[model samples]
Every structure is written in C-alpha cells, then in structure tokens.
Target: MVEIKFNGQRYAYWQQVHISASVDDLAASVTLAVTRPGTGQRLGVDANTVIEVLIEGTVVTTIRPDSIRRHVDANSHSIDIEARSLGRELIDCQYSQTLSGLSLDEIVKRLCSTFNVPVQVTAKAAVVPDFSLQCESPANALINAARAANLLLYATPDGGLLLTEPSSAAPVATLVYGEHIESYTVVDEYKLRYSDYLVKGYDYRNDLALKGAVKDSGITFFRPLHIMADKTGQGVGGCDRRATTERNRRQARANRIDLEVVGWTHAGGVWDINSQVRVIIPDEDIDGVYLIGDRAFTLDDQRGSMTRLSVMKREAFLGDPAPGKAKRGAKHKAKSQDERLIYATDLE
Candidate 1:
C-alpha cells in the first residue's frame, strides 16, 4: 500500500499515482491525483508544498510539489500534483568560485557547507590543482567536479547528499525474456563508441607540452574508425600516467548500450538505482548482467502494478584506472625575460 503526507498531514484520497526514480540523472519524481473535497471543503495543497511518499511502510521519497492542477466536470472534481526529490534544491541554488589545490572530496564538502546541505562520502579520490568554473547552478558545478575524478554525487531521499563510486553489489533479481518480460527495447548506439583518444595537457612549471594517445584494438574492422580529443585542467601532472588514466575512463564510459525492459514483477522497493541484475533473452542470443540506471513504478485500477527498468552494461561503472608515479627530467625552453612587458592589442 502507498501513503502520502502533505505538509505534516496524512491524506488517503488518491485514485492513482506514478513514481519514477533514476540514478543516471540522480532524481526521483511523483504524480498523484486526488478527488476534490465535498461541499464546504477546499484542497489546501499548493506549488512548492513539501510531501513525503511511503510504500509498504518504507519512505520512498521526500519531495516538493513542482506543479498542481485542478479539474472540474459535471460529476466530480479532482486535483493533480507533481513533485520531485530534494536534489532539486541544489539545482535551485546558484554558486560561483575558483578552487585551487583541493581534492574532489574537499570541493564537494565545501559546496555543501555553503548551501547548508548534508553530505556523506564513501569513496576516495585523487587531489588535483585549480578547478575553476562559472556554472549555471551549484548542482552543475558539483557534478562536473566529481566527474573529473571519476566519481558520482547524488541526493538521498532524506535531504542528504551521497558521493561515491558506482556500486558493485550482486544481483537482487533476475528476468527472463519469454518468462516475465512484457516488452523490451535495445539500442546499440554504435556511433557513440570510440576506439582511440588523444589527450593533451601542459605543465607550466616545466614549460613543457604533454601529449598522449591510447587505442583499443578490441573493436573489429567493421567499426574501426573513431577518435576523440580531451583537454585536461592545469592541476593534472604532465605525465604519461595521468593521460592514460583519463583515456581509460573515457573509453569505458563510451562502451555502453541503452536498454529498457518492462516486466510484471514486484520490483518497486526490492530494486533501486545502481543495482546489478541478470537479464536473459534467449531469442535474441543476448544474456548478460546489467545495472539498473532508472526505474518507473505505476499502479492503477486497470493495470494493477508493473515495473519498467532502464539499464546499461555493468562495465560502464568500473573504478578509475591507476595513475603511476610522475615522470622526471622532462623540460622545455622558457620565454625570454626581456619580453616580460608585452602590451595587449586593442580591437578597433
């Protein structure tokens, strides 16, 4: 059973509800409809009202209403409410700054502190120099900073933030193609795959230009042509190890396929974002393990209840590759001291 609390009050007049949660975007949302109150009563909920949804005695999400709508007909009246998880707060808050010589953990911790938000970190990350950016919002800045170190930052339902590596848990459930699956769709997205990457960075102290490239020969000739360029920030050391680490991270992310499958199973509270599961499709000769990236749970009078899952290959979330010890003796010529007083050119 599902229950809802609106503004510290309990309500039980909902006719139907739909909930969607995802790890890829780090967000959860709900849409619910309730019958209008009788003769002398009025609905007391409005946009931005806080709401908590519980399923089977467990809190599913703590959200705020994004929109509210009312409908009136000859026989009855009803109101519809839509809400999103607390992570929306981060998106709503804007922040700007340039951080130098800070670890990924420190940067996220400071950002959360500035916003008075709660945070929990479970994994370790490398320290780099000079992360500078003007983001559209605080949430964007946090996400981009984390991604640079191959980490993920997402919000919990109870208004807390989680920074960690992707989970490596065992499968919670299994689904067979002709047995439990109602429908399924597979997307190869071959064009997005890349076989080689060219990474470039500069070491200001040594006045040296660093360039590195990596190629994966695993891909057959049928799809052989692909390359990408990457620019590393100032803090990344100008060494082969750093460039190799960046290349491996990029390749792993690009080696993915998009898949969505619908099944008639009670996976609502049992399965969640970042969980691993086994998917078997005998007819298509496809049977492999995958990570649940997104999920949608729906309940109604006619359709009863069903679960839909969006999944990706498990290798996509592997840990970052190691960056070996820095190289020595690399040097370059410095600019002449006599040219120190260069003047800026003005445009006419």
Candidate 2:
C-alpha cells in the first residue's frame, strides 16, 4: 500500500526493512525501485516530503530524501528505482496457533501488544461468508500476477496461500484493498468504491497510536466483508486508469477469464462509462466474458483490488451488485445483520 505515485520519479526507501538479515549479514539495507510512464502530473512527492516504507508486510522505517538518496543517470530505461533499508530491524515471522481460529486482526494484536491501537475497527467478524464453492484462488492468483507482489494475501484456507502462524487470527497491521460501493445496500451493490464516497481510506501511520501496527485487513481491499483502506490511504477511486484495453490488444487471447467495463457511478450521479461492455475473447470461438464466468471484474482503485467471488450465480451477478430475491423470508437472518453492521462500516 505504500506506493510512490509520482511523475517520472525514481525513489528508494531507507525506512522499513522487511527482509531476513543478521548482525553478521553484510548488506545494510533493503531497497525497492519504482518508475512511472512519464506523463501524468505527480504531486504527492517533494524533496522534503518524507514517506513511510513497508517491507514484506512490515513497516521497517522512514527515511528522508537526503538519507534515502537517489541518482538519475543518462538512461531513460530505468523505470524502477530501489528503496533500501537503513538501520532497520531484521524481519522475522513466527507461526502461532489459536483454537479460536486465526485471522489478520489477531496477528496485529500480538505484534503490537504494547501499544493502544488507534484503529477504528469499523467492524469485525470472526466469520467469513461460506462462499459455497470457495474464495476464488484464480482471483488471488490473478492478483499475484497483476500486482508485482502478493500485496494482499488470500487467507480463506483455499490451500493456495500460506496461512499465518497458528495464533488463529487475521492481520493485525495490514493495507486492505477494496471497493466502496454505495448506490444500493444489496450484496450485488457491494462494489462501493472510495470514488463513490462509499469507501473510506485511512493512513493509520499518521496516528501515533496505530504506528508500526497492522491496523486491520478491513482497510485492505479484499472481500465484500474485509477492508483496510483506513490504514494506508490505499482507497481505490473511480477515476483509475484501466489496463485491460492494452492487455486485450495483444495476440490470440481468449477464453479462461473475461474482462469488461460495465457501469460506474460518476460525478454527482451514476452512469455507465461505456455503452456496451460485453464479455468477449478474440480469435477463439469463445466470446463475451466467457473466461471468468462472465461475472468477475476488478475496480480501478489500486488499494482495493481483490474482488472476492460472489455466492450468487453468474447470471445473478450480471447487471450489478443489487440483490434479487427479497431475503426477509428466504434464508439466514441476512437482512437484520446487514441493517446492523452496514451502517457501522461499509455502508456510505
């Protein structure tokens, strides 16, 4: 979640070292190289503006522009720069177990037990939606390939990800990613993104109480239930630049998963960005969102990218996040729970 969205900028963080090393280790720092496409106007960075750096799910340290240091040679090809750690702590993780079942929340509590957490648990639930099939692995796998790293860890016991120690808890300090949908209160309407004012992003590092602590995966963009935008200002907005177009232009790509631009809420209102966003793959006989079952699609907000699979069938997920049947008499006490918790957090 700690990204440097600057124009033609190359930065190396001297703060926050999340790598394995020892007093006997020779290297003094860990670094990251970042480069942009050179066109947009970058504003959040400055020569004196110092930002925090997070390494391997850990916040190592913060360094100044001078201390971090930077050099731009005659080569225009260096799209990425490296951010190295200074006098940071050696990073290590231990496996802990909890009979209550572990999750991100438990992880942070154990890590920062000494501090009073500044995080506003907008809401917490030991339960995750059953997801009849399973929380999609291809989805998280797609993300792993999409974003250079597994920035958002998938923890649904899908046999895909490495679950944290047995401590039986979710992330205590995390950069959650998710949409902030707000037009409707239905499950299908859950794409509420920060751009729609349906989602809220917070930078917990600014709060002394939450410093160096994994606030909550709720802030991180994941399923319709979890979020962590509040911890790292990683809220995804509506105005994000989509890459599917470029990705589509390439050779013989079809089948598997489909991608499309359906509709989006905009300016003082809601509207569709494209008139006809059909699911289609090229060359192969298959077309029209055939790969991802014509249902899964990602929002533009960088912070919230993991769009957890909806229990609703592909056809049900067609139009939008709006629910179909009236649930008052159908099944679980969903209506009452929605009324109770939606107001507390995800609800706009």
Candidate 3:
C-alpha cells in the first residue's frame, strides 16, 4: 500500500499517487491527487511543507513541494501536488570555487554541505591533485567528479547524498514475464552507438594536449564520436578513461528492457535503483541479470498500483562492454545483428 504523511498526520482519500526515482539522477519525485477532505483536514500543504512517502510501512523517500494545484467546483474539490527530493537544491544552486588536492569523496561532501545536504561516500575514489570550479552548478561539479572516478552519486531515501558503486552482490529478485512483470518493452537502437570514440583534452599544468580513443566493435560501418574533454578529463590518461566510459554508457543504454510490474514492493522492500535483478523473457530470448537504473511507482483508479522499471546490463557501470544476446533478425555476414555488437572494446 502507498501512504503520504506530513506534519505527523497521514493523508487519506488520495485518488492517485505517482513517484519516480533513478540511480543516475539526484532527485526523486512525487505527484499526488487528493480527493475531497473533510473540514479541518485540508492538509495545509505548501511549498514549505515536507512530505514523507511510505510503501508497505517502509519509508521510500521524502519530498518538498515544488508545485501544488487546487481545484474546486460547485460539486467537487480536489488538490494536485508535485514534489521532489532535497537534492534539488544542488541542481538549482550555483557556486564558484577552485578546489585543489581533494579526493572525489571530499569534493562531493563539501559541495553538498553548502546546501545543508548530508552525504555518504561508500565507494573508493582517488585523490586528485587539483580541482576547480567557476560559476558552476554544484550538481554538475559533483556529477563530473563522480563520473570521472567511475562512481555513482544519487540521493538517499532520507534526501541525503550517497556516493557509491553499483551493487556487486546477489540478485535481489528473479522477475519472470507473465508472473511478476505485467508488461515489457525491448529497446534496441543502434544509432546511439559509434564505431570509434575519440576524447581530446588539454593538460594546462603541463601545457600539453591529451587524447584518448576507444571503439565499439559492434558497428560494422564507420561511425565516430568526438568529444572535447572537460576539466575533469585533464589528468594522466583521463581522456582515454573518459572515452571508454562514454562508450560503455552508450552501449548499455542502446539496448534495455522496460518492465511494468504489479506492485511497488518486492520481496525485500520497495523497488530500488542500482540493485540487480534477474529478468527472464522467454519469447525475446532475454535471460540475464540487469541493474535497475530507473523506476517509477504509480497508483490510480485505472491501474490500481504498478511499478515501471528501466534496466540495463550491469557491466555498463563497470567500465566494461555488455554484449547483448542475439536477437532474431537478418544476418550480418556470419554473425547476427546482436552478436556483432560487443562492449566498449577494440576487438575484431
């Protein structure tokens, strides 16, 4: 069941609820449509109010209202509320600072602290000799630093920040189509991939130019992507690592599975991002363990309750190629279209 609470009171008679979250994004969102409320139960929700969202008695997230719409007519009265996690501050605020000789963890904690946001770094990241920012969004600075270190930075359930790696443990649940999943869509778009990825940058400290190049062996034709590296891509072999990271992320995104499940809670608890799950779609010949990158929980009169999940290969986050299973299609030379595609590697 879904519940919304504020000011030590649980709201009742909400007609619809929708919550969206992602591991790649720093903010989780909630939208609610409330029906008629008795006198003195108007909720008194406003922009200053903070809402606690719970599923099956477990707290999922906390949100601050970004928008609220009230509808009233002679016959009916209703309210629509939209809110987002506290991390929204980082995305909205800008800062100018030139940080030097700090680890990625330290840099992130420092920036988050500016907005009174708590942070927890669970992954291992190297200390950089120098880092700088000028009129930059704290979100952008945090994202770049984390990406360069191959780490993940997202909002915790309590609206704090968590810097970590993808979970490497066991699969949280095994979801089979027609059982746990109500519907699914397989996405395969080759245009997102390229034959070559070349990243170029400059090392201002040494007054030298840097270049890093990687390739996607899946593309039989000639397609190349050239990227001008940012400040984070200036150190030794930084451009090369950036190029490889780009390739892996794109390859993983090129092929994904979007699933709509029946409920919001899994065996353990609420559906979470960055957790691995086993997916089995017999008709599509897709049987693999995937990482949940995005999720949305929705409830309404029509659908009752459901959760939509967007998942991709786990190797995508690990700086490795995630070769997909062969799809039924016209052959490309000796290999099928899917078989020809490999992770971000320079192999024939």
Candidate 4:
C-alpha cells in the first residue's frame, strides 16, 4: 500500500497515484489524486507543503508540492497534487563557485549544501585540479563532473543527492514474459546511433591535444559524430573515457526494452532504478541481462497497480570493457532468426 503523510497526518487512501524515478533525472516526481480531505480537516492541500511518501511501510521519498488542483462535482470532490523531491532545488537554482584541487564528491557536497540538500557519495574518484561554476545550475555542474569521473549523480529516494557508479552485482530478479510482465515494447532507434564517435580535447595546462574514437559495429554506414570534451574531461584518459561513454549510452538507448509489470514490489524489495534485471522473452528473442534505467509506480481505476520499467544494456552506465562485442552474440543470433513484432498498445 502507498501512504502520504503531511503535517503529522497519514493518508492511507488515494484515488490515483503515479510516481516516477529515473537514473537520468535528478529528482523523483509524484502525482496524487484523492477524494476527501487527506490533509486532516484542511479544506485543501497547501502549496509547497512537504510530504513524505511511504510504500509497504518503507520510506520512499520526501516531496514538496509544485501544484495543487481541486475539483468538485454534484457528488464528488477531489484534489490532484503534483510534487517533486527536495533535490529539485539543485535543478532549479543557480550557483556560482570556484574551487581547485577537490574531488568530485567534495565539489558535489559543497554545491548541494548551499541548497540544504543532503548528499551521499558512494563511489571514489580522482581529484579535479580545477573546477568553476558561473551562475550555472548545480544539477548540470554535478552531472558533468560525475561524467568526467565516470560516475552518476542522481537524487536518492529520501530527497537527497547520490553520487555513485552503476552496480556490477548480480541481477536483482528475472522478469519473464507471460508471467510477471503485463506488457512489453522493443524500440529500435537508429537516429541516435553513428558509425564513428570522435572525442577531441585540449589540455591547456599541459599544452597537449587529446583524441579518442570508437565505432558502432551495428551502424555499418559512414555516419559520424564529433564531440568536444568539456573542461572536466581535458586529458587523454578523460577523452577516451568520454568517447566510450558516449558510444555505450547511444547504443543502449538506440535499442530499448520497455516493460509493464503487475504490482510494485519484486521478490526482494521495491522496484529500484540503476539496478540490473534479467529479461526472458523467447518470441522477441530478448533473453539477456539489462540495466533498469527508469521506473514508475502507477495506480488508477483501469490499472489497479503496476510498475513501468525501461531497461537498456548493462554497459550503458557501467562503462564496461569494449561494450557488447563479446556478450551480445547469442542474443544477436536469436534476433536475426525472427522478424520483430510491433506492440501497438505500447504506443498509447
């Protein structure tokens, strides 16, 4: 069950609820609709009210409402509330800071503290010689810095920031078609893919030029993409890592698997982002391990309770070695044996 608490009140019932979390975004988003006064005897929920959300007696996120709408009819009264995690402050606020010789975690902690957003660093990274932020969004700065360090920076479920790398552990669970999966979609997008990815940079301090290049074996054509390494990624090693990251991200996204499963909890715990899961769908020939990049817990009259999962190849965020060449053989062979089918319902 889902619970929303505000001003020391617990609202155990809701007409509709949708909560979305993703590795690519810095804040988790929530939309709730309910009849009656969920906020005690109050007529309506106040703007910018701090709310704590819990699922199955476990704290998930603390959110502040960005919008609240009320509706009344002849027999029914309801309110729709939209909220986001406290980490939204980092995305919405501008910050200016200049620091030298600090690690990625230190830079993130400093910026996050300015907005009173708590931070946790789970990965260790090298120190950047210099860093600067000129009235920029802290979210962007943190994201770029983490990318340079080959890490990820996203909002935690508890309304704080987390800096970490993708998990290399075992799959949390296996999702099988016709069992746990309610629906599925396989998307093949070539627009984002390129035959060659070239990353170029210059290290001003060392007066040296750096270059890194990688190819998309699937593209086969002569399409190429050129990228300029940012200030953080200014060295030869940094440029190479950036190039590999770009290619892996594009390839993973170019072919995505979206699934809708019944209920919210897996065997071990609640559905989570940045975790790995094994997928088995014989007809689609998609029997492989994947990374859960996005998750959404949704409930309504039509769909009582369900979770939406968007998964990509594990190498997308892990930055694994030479991504996909050695592991995709069996899956590729199976895919070649059959023509792909269009899941029309997924479009809507």
Best by TM-score: 3
Q: Candidate 3 lDDT, tens digit per residue, 198-313? A: 86555445444556788899997899998766665343126666777778878878888999999898888888998999999999988989999889999899988899999998
C-alpha lDDT of residue 168 in model 2: 16
Q: What Cα-based lDDT does every candidate model obtain?
A: 0.59, 0.22, 0.75, 0.74
Q: What is the TM-score of each predicted model, taking all chains together?
A: 0.73, 0.21, 0.87, 0.85
lDDT of 2 by residue, 226-321 (tens): 221121112111001011111121111221232222222222222111112222223333233211111222233342222211111122111112
lDDT of 1 at 38: 45
- TM-score (C-alpha, index-matched) for candidate 2: 0.21
Clashing residue pairs in candidate 4, if any? none
Root-mean-square deviation (CA) per prediction: 6.7, 21.2, 9.8, 10.7
Off by over 4 Å in 1: 12-16, 35-43, 46-48, 194-268, 300-302, 324-348
Clash counts for the predictions, in order:
0, 67, 1, 0
lDDT of 4 by residue, 1-348 (tens): 889887888887777989998887789999988886334334345765778888887777888888888777666677787899989988887766777787778877887888888789898777766666666676766665566556777778778888888877789999999998989999889898999987655544544455677788988889998865555543113656667777777777888999999999988889888889999999998899888988999999898989999999766864434222111111221122222211101000
For model 4, the stretches where C-alpha displacement exceeds 4 angstroms are 36-48, 235-237, 320-348
Write down the lDDT that model 4 would get. 0.74
Comparing candidate 2 with candidate 3, which one achieves the higher TM-score? Answer: 3
